[model samples]
Target: MQASDRYRLSASATWVASVQMEPAIGAVAANLARSIELVEMAAAQGAQLVVLPELANTGYMFESREEAYALAEPVPEGRSSQAWIALAQRLGIYLVAGISERAGGRLYNSALVTGPDGYLGTYRKLHLWGDENLYFEAGDLGLQVFDTELGRIGVAICYDGWFPEVYRRLALRGADIVAVPTNWVPMPGQTRDGAVIAHALTMGGAHSNGLTVVCADRIGTERGQTFVGRSVIVNSQGWTAAGPASVDQEEVLLAPIDVKATRRARQLNDFNHLLRDRRPDIYDEQSGATAGLRQR
Candidate 1:
């Protein structure tokens, strides 16, 4: 409320939501129906940006690569993608959802982004986890930061959040918010404080990068694998803006995010800035990541 703090914001705040739901295996029709319903609910509650869980269409746990291909569809033009685009246009809001994308005779775990203007772009998941390697190709699309009326938005999938580099790279590319569509499972070795492994990852990613992180995770067991369902939204200060919802329920976490303040939070105190303080002059990725970005 102080006049000096006005520099933390450049425009109005945006109301966003993380829609947590359970999608069934290969049940494209049913999953699409349910996801549409939940997005509508979030919009009804005044969400300008709504994010859905990973594999929001065909679900996780494919029986085979053949099954995965059978359930996957093309990007933007796919029936599922078209439906979601229409929903975003109708609601006059931005929507991000996970989909099983079939492209170039290969299958990818992808997220489709849409807005009131229509289809925006697709982000193929960079890090494939567990059985994902067996069925889906590791994401080919590099870090993509989408500029929208609300702000600069970015997308990441489940396993991608595990790497600090992913968040760091997105922040470096000028992203204000990172929408994570995840299907989280339990991490081995419980902590003394009993914090959720996912909480540590998302909150840390947000605080270190000064980005708002909105995660929508799925629940339920399919083919003997259970998903941990504590969906959450983390603010730039590494604090909970909304949830870490129930471990067994379907829920929608809605919150108002001050994106400009988040971007400004990168400046800690009067002397240090998170991004500017990086010692990239002496340190290097050594993993060839910079070369890849340059090629792109």
Candidate 2:
């Protein structure tokens, strides 16, 4: 190996992985075991950061609020979270996974972040989608970004991708990579032959924010609900670095990202910068113009 090539690789590369798996409804134990196996596999392939789909421990569909509450667990202290933290520490990798969180009498859709040291923090889903509103409260923790040896990491869950403000806020806070743990379902007008809208949304968010977006999605049908499995890793240029994995398969997508380089790429040209050129003041002032439309 050439010394120059080794030096370049060490300075510029960070490997990441996205795990797409199918979780049986209410099967917490089995799901956590599978997740650990997949993370180990990703680490074997040299992934420094590993991401898993939303609610990866407890499957997405719940028959009733009672069932959801029964499945929800405390963050970091939950058995599933502790297992993941131990795995991350043992493998010297970073892990971000979604879990149903129970706090007092309320349940929240949350994502847990852990690294080689231990639990970092959690990001509750800020936006609830469809039936999720029936079971979980909307997030109150706000947007969270964690600083680590790898880089600045941000987290978002499922439907949060539909809101542009989510990515903008993270970018404004200097996030280099955003790990999205999603459970994408077929939206209205979705067809088997068409491009998945979720994928398009993630790509747009990544390019606009100059953030590398890593999405880990679930597959398979649970109860009567079907999840669209198109887990993907998009580079800062809005290009697919790894997947959009099989629509109904369990797979791991691996990619190498240079977060520092992507952060620098935010400057589109000598005369333009993506975030700096934002006219936030004008938007805030004219926000009234859209108030009527919003009311409708």
Candidate 3:
């Protein structure tokens, strides 16, 4: 069979990533209602999957862990997460949304993937920002790729995308498409200097993994911090299939992805996978102390 013929393709399915705009700070009710409205709107537009920005429910300026904890909810049962799950079930689609998670008396910055089958998976931000370490414990969960109606989908939150290891890990785990929901703050000169870096990260990850990478970053300012609103979708061969948008307004970017093509492209081109074919036997050699290690 042809390489493309060997893979599954669902032409009827469409994926939408909502660059959820932030409302006024501490406006929990407003944010909740806005998300629900977007869910309905996305469904009406024929989206089989939808992604939301980080910290969708609560604002990002919480001064203390206590405040964030007070808003966190369990993965399958928190009030906010329950609403998202119910929406996914009601809409009969897959939804990945970042939420402030509270579990076992601790707060976490987490993302949940819900489908018609209730909660599909959850990802806690493995990489935390500056003061984030003070409020929430860093997540020990590794990269994740969940089987969905659309395809094998990988999930990662904001800071997780900054490191190449995060993307490589997800790709190694067999991800066909990676969805990242972020509130990526753009530093003053980073945009000019960082465009190349950002492009390198996106293209390198996509080409190497043979997976389409879709990133949905928040627009507008939140908690007096500016965000880099360039939500984009890159194809397997390191091509920008979709765009790099502006940070000024609320926008919904759409792209029809061919998952089979991504796989085929990798095979036809024999794309960069040298990193995947490393000699672990020699790489794992433990050096520091032979006698002490053997004695212990």
RMSD after CA superposition, every candidate: 5.6, 3.1, 5.7
Error of 2 at 282 (Å): 0.9
- Model 1 lDDT tens row, 167-216: 99999999999999999887787542356888899999999999999999
lDDT tens readout by residue for model 3, 77-161: 8777889999989999888887888779777788888999898878889999877888888886778889976888898877777
Instruction: Itemize residue pairs with steric clashes in candidate 2.
Output: none
Residue 58 error, candidate 2, Å: 0.5
The local distance difference test score of model 3 is 0.73
Which of candidates 1 and 2 reaches a greater lDDT? Answer: 2
lDDT per residue as tens, model 2, 1-296: 34345336776788899999999889999999999999998888778999999999999998899999999999989899999999999999999999999998999999999999999999999999988999999999999899999899999999999999999999999899999999999999997547899889999999999999999999999989888898999999889999889889899998889977898899999999999999765575455546557779
Candidate 1 ranges with C-alpha deviation above 4 Å: 1-11, 190-194, 286-296
Error of 3 at 222 (Å): 2.7
10 residues in a row with least lDDT, candidate 2: 1-10
Whose lDDT is greatest here? 2
The clash count of every prediction, one per candidate, is 0, 0, 2
Per-model TM against the reference? 0.91, 0.93, 0.84
lDDT of 3 at 262: 60
